[model samples]
Target chain A: MNESWDEIGQLFKNARSIVILSHVRPDGDAYGSSLGLAWTLRALGKEVLVCNEDGMARSYRFLPGSEEVVSTPKTAPQGCDIVIAVDTSTQERLGPTFALWNRKVDINLDHHASNTCYGTWNLIDPLAPASALVCYKLLQALGWTCPKEAASCFYVGLLTDTNAFRFCPLSPDVFRMAAELVEQGADPLSLSEGAYRNYSIGQFHLLREILAQTVFAWENRVAYYRLTPALLKQTGAENTEVENFLTYLQKVSTVQVAFMLEELEPNLTRVSLRSRAPIDVCQIAQRFGGGGHPRASGIRARIPMAEMEKLLLEEIRQVLQ
Target chain B: MNESWDEIGQLFKNARSIVILSHVRPDGDAYGSSLGLAWTLRALGKEVLVCNEDGMARSYRFLPGSEEVVSTPKTAPQGCDIVIAVDTSTQERLGPTFALWNRKVDINLDHHASNTCYGTWNLIDPLAPASALVCYKLLQALGWTCPKEAASCFYVGLLTDTNAFRFCPLSPDVFRMAAELVEQGADPLSLSEGAYRNYSIGQFHLLREILAQTVFAWENRVAYYRLTPALLKQTGAENTEVENFLTYLQKVSTVQVAFMLEELEPNLTRVSLRSRAPIDVCQIAQRFGGGGHPRASGIRARIPMAEMEKLLLEEIRQVLQ
Candidate 1:
């Protein structure tokens, strides 16, 4: 990782115009790292562009330089010499922009253990909580001062990736870095408000619909909720609003695993699982040809919600027993 | 405040046996300040007794030395040279134990702006985010090294009072202090889990019932939910679990005020108000003969739930217009 960091720093030093891209459907971490690195490069008098095939989410527009984000496959300046991929583990995760780059990835900075090492130089630390932390370290090693704008972007990324530090893997170094970011002018409270507090009216209605249908089994140790297409239509809630629905069950002290089933179509179901106990939901997801972090995982099943729920519950019951 | 700090420090320096007390029905800040100060005094070779009239909550039993907390008015050792109130603002908030202290309070440490100054020397800084911060400052002023145990106690108080640092009132200094505590061996993730992730099964059922009947008014600017005896009984939820129910509404993007009405008896309604906008729910609560902070307040009415809802809606409409 240190060798890759030095190599990436050398590449940045050698390039004048650089383009930075993150994964499609970018979350706060993706936006934060891309924008933060973009701002840092701009500060060094380099021409820079940040791109994603799927544009920034409305929730993340509060980021300082989000307005500068360009849609993917945009033509870069003639002199663009370096391309950096951030927060993307696999090449395909770059969406159409992966083919648009046409050149080898000069630098790949990510925190996912699954990173494909598609770059000429890769700096990946799976232990790091967020890619924004990697970006901050890179800037520090390169002797760049993180101004207020860059700090805000990085802070937001860290906040979102850690679920505002409620995730168990957060180390003390994360908090120390957070303190440094605050010194660099990241207002944590305001960033938190923008990232977590902003919720659409439709989201509340959607929550009501989902909660009303919540079911518990296995002595309340296994709780599950489903969001049907009809409920979505009635509440006018977009799919993204359900991203955090699993948390409502994850907090139950007695619940070992919580399942969220979203009906993507009449007969297809997308299931998200969250486990708070020693149980590994990732293993369960893998059985369904899906995977994620140990505590959170997902899969898509080509079956009705009823059948899918039964299969998932039986799997959990087997695991618990 | 500085003058009182010096006097308080001198008293600590001269004392052999000290009894530390916080408000009745102690919250995290109350437990944090009292326990932190107790540990600090113990480090100074002083015999310390931590007491609260209503005892520590089950949630805070994780704090080190929590078992040592004496639900008061317990007898202090003979030669207990000083009486210290760590987080209590008024003598009454100290509970019946206040009358047990025959001598005047030698030191009163608090963060409330309305501290009654019932002590011979009072160290109160309303600007401080939590009483634990004040206690940490006090220990620092007196040149004390906070061991791992003491740091954990203080960290819990800061974490709980600031709602895990999501509150807008938290400043950069709080993060810095949090960093120092982590360095002293306080684990932020575990502290957070102990304080937030440990929710009862009944709480989720209670949330479901409440969300199913959430009411929105005034163009969705005001949202309210009521917990009746029947619903609570059905969900098997205790009254204490509903303390944070209003937060369910506070996160709504357009909500100005969120009201939580709980029927304590057939005709007695206890109303808790939370506001996110410029409207002062405290003022509204005051008109109902109850009061609290600007963002959160509460009151009780002898009228039925339907009549109370009418009165509240009318009051909120008046404020909005």
Candidate 2:
């Protein structure tokens, strides 16, 4: 009775409680997918629990069930019914809470190119933006009229993942799904502001700080900046601000390569690279066991902060040359 | 004999001198159109002169014939048989030399949307990028294959005016003409660097100065930055630096409306505004007698610089609210 999607819907109909979980370091797609799925499940007469390891980013407050996300263990009871994971491709990313359940049965949903098929009942499609888009379609298949809450959740996920379709990483099915979501009342202005307008005072100061320290590696047509922990503290900025600063650097005149190194610990570092031209920062990132697309990528290069900066700069120069 | 296309080609076939003049603010299109036209004419046995208003930005130094541009006139012999004015839709944009010529005796080609139909033999198709794209076709009309030099010239204009297709302010015909120019000998990579690379230290320093004075009209999501004459002087920055700073303010996280107020004079200010979303800054720019696109635009307003800043900021804020 629990094998197929029809069976899954029947399980939802029978279950009294549901908890939707997304990966840590939640992004637009991750956050959107979680909220959209939770909203849909709640509409199916299930008491839903949307849980994440970290807090929601300030920008996504407009999402329907975003505020309801419970990050602490105190909120969940012994049994959380059938747990559904969204946007998470691996168990480690679920991060330290895999034991929170008393071996509850789970359904995993995701849309990453490298899905690990982690859940007991895995439904991974690398083509969708957020699992929420897939979740939205599934609810439709189950004969659910997407309530306003569910619609808003899916809309937020679609909006953020696509950057209003500026740099869509999704397939054709994603946009067709997005169009249907918009027809059901997705406000483009609000969506744009929620995803793009969200920035903090410290983040803006961080931008100025890093930009001031920006070293244009003119010979390589590369530009880079670093955010040491001390510097981040000095500017009262976070790791995320370093991510946004690199976005601005990528647009510099004649600059095809951009790198930002953030101090994760006193000695360890995290590297984020973006290339506007044909250079492959992905392969560079993959050398450190991290992976991403050709245009955008990240790597957890666990070298001393100073050496990591030098290594990345020299590495990019050598590789691209 | 002077009216037929072949007669014009035959007339230039024996000419000892020809003056090549492009419009002021010689953009890629203007440079491409004129330079390509000149080389094609030169190859067909005409003595060609590429004259312009001033030294091009260093970013343009790699363009073909860029080094030979005549910013200041030296000596001119008796009149040549042909004078081609390119990317110059209006006589005023051609400056002092344009006023000295008789409209009935000169050949003009342009692609300005607001071209005033001001030439004796005007080829005004506002849809094209630089007059150079049209000039490429004219090379074919003159029964000449685009020589390398001619191809490079046209490449510069095409790269500049189209902003390398990042700013597609032209029609499809313009791109098709550009394709033919590339096939003729346009090296897009070198052309991309020559047109967009080669950033000067002064420009980068000026960029830093502009970021220092960034301010936000917070409630309406309008942010503006000041680039005072003092800032430019302190940094030893060129006017081109101000052009580079044009989009800086618009990129602020919460900024939907961005303005850069450059003090061209104590009472005169050049306001450049950019928008990421759909709020049209052009409507605000046009209200003040300036016109441009919705996303990117400019306005020249004369008032005390500070007052002009306040007034313009308030005016733009009204739109968002």
Candidate 3:
């Protein structure tokens, strides 16, 4: 059910023990929203537990209350009066944690338009720049002040989800919320440093190798890079470190479409696509049984890396033409 | 003399024609502030002319009213009743344009801590994130709303000056002002795309070459790169395109100090230095007759590229120790 902020506030206020869960392989938003809500609840003298299927990434360990988040619940789900999912778009996104707790989710807080709303009460604002902003607004609606730790966590969520305010259609409210969060002790520099600037030496090496191998096509309007397991092994960089390297290609002035062909296995390739405005990369990805937003999308092809590249390039060329 | 906002507002209100000037090698802030103030003054039914020594860079040509900014004044400066300098720190920084205007500057608006009170009415707020922001506050204090074009220009100034809000000590007021600017018609995505995302293909190639040749020292705590004229010719990139690539080295988690040795000439090497907190690169830069902030500095040595590299590495190693 689509519930109002007042209803959600009442539900939280009445609950003695609440458990928060986020998506698998949790990003800053997932951990940030979960921990932010946890900190706010604990400040209200309520028992709060935060959990994620994959736990926290090393980069986000500096966030307050990160140490308290558990991969597995120590207590029974039945003992908690409320089970709230934060930043998780669908029930399955909770991963293995969803199977462990079979009860109906009491609340679902999210900003994603794709949210399935499987909870008994759902608060989804697609206009919200980030899920953390939704949590901040919910606290405001309840006449409760966000704790300092919660403010920092929410700021991280806002910072990373928006690509440090680069990607989002930044609204007045987004900046206002950011301002209030800063006033409440959210350090933008430190949070951004911890989230974006912390790159390993191995990651740096991997970036170098990837850029060195970049190929441009169609009057330099399209750029693509191939990442192989051999390259990963040679650079000693994890796959996760390659998540944002496609941005390097996208930033090129003449490039309209930028993609990465990552060889996942002997005959399987995962392709990530990004394009500028007026070009829908999601349509290109959908042709290969994959999908995402208009500007950014992904596909997993059951073909060799070269074959996948050829097929994707043909599709992108048609769009460019 | 230092002037109050009301006094500056009255001076602008009374002026019939105003000439605005920015420093040499104009950046986003320089042009943004000049154009933003021009648009505001035009909206107030005042005749305004914006001039710069180097004119606007090709990248910032997308900004509103950019075409109006000229490298040389069309009419004599004496024809204008007021001469205002925006974002230019010192009087000499205004370059040859200062000599063109023999009259005393009526108003000097800036956010640089090193700004000299060169105007009859000077409003320098070092705490302000950008000079455009100071102009925004001045308009607000005069009960004037920022025009849409001016808002976009000011947004660019703030966005670029703060490195997309990454470098500034983001206080509540900064975000609040940004929120106001966005509400008044600053499209953040388009503005940021124009300001930062537009990198030439040659620039991308230069970045790739620079990364490929990166050298790490002191257990990866110090990373440096050499950019010779041959590399520039090979990549087909202009020297202007190499301004921000030092950030690539600074982002490595293990790197405390990152520098770039650019071979400006066969016997002249320009070295740019950047370091994290608790390390003062300005001191190191000062030893070579150059200076800047503690974290970011530069030096131009008449030494050859190889000799300059060796000497700078020795200085950096001592600091690292």
TM-score of 1: 0.90
Q: Model 3: what TM-score?
A: 0.93
Could you arrange the candidates by DockQ from highest to lowest? Answer: 3, 1, 2
Chain A in model 1: its TM-score? 0.91
lDDT (0-100) at residue B23 of candidate 3? Answer: 84
Number of the predicted model whose TM-score against the real structure is largest = 3
Worst 10 residues of 3 chain A by lDDT: A70-79
Local distance difference test, each candidate: 0.81, 0.67, 0.85
Query: Which sections of candidate 2 miss by over 4 Å?
Result: A1-4, A72-76, A102-105, A129-132, A136-144, A163-173, A253-256, A276-282, A292-295, B1-208, B216-222, B228-257, B265-267, B273-298, B304-307, B310-321
Q: Whose DockQ is higher: candidate 1's or candidate 2's?
A: 1
Error of 2 at B19 (Å): 23
User: Candidate 2 residues A55-151, lDDT tens each?
Assistant: 6766577676678887836345655678788877676677576555445337887767666776778777666656677678677777877766676
**Model 1 interface DockQ:** 0.59
Q: Each candidate's DockQ score against the native complex?
A: 0.59, 0.09, 0.77
Residues B1-321, model 1: lDDT tens digits: 744556667777888998888886578889988998888789889998888887767667778899999887645557888888887777877887566755677788898876789988888888887899998988888888897889989988888777677745656677778878888888776677677766776677788878878899999889999888898889887666476777778777778889988888889999989886467888999898877677777787798888899999999899973
- Order by TM-score, highest first: 3, 1, 2
lDDT of 3 by residue, B9-65 (tens): 777778899889988777788889999989998999999988888776777898999
Which docking class does model 3 fall in?
medium
List chain B TM-scores, each candidate: 0.88, 0.80, 0.90
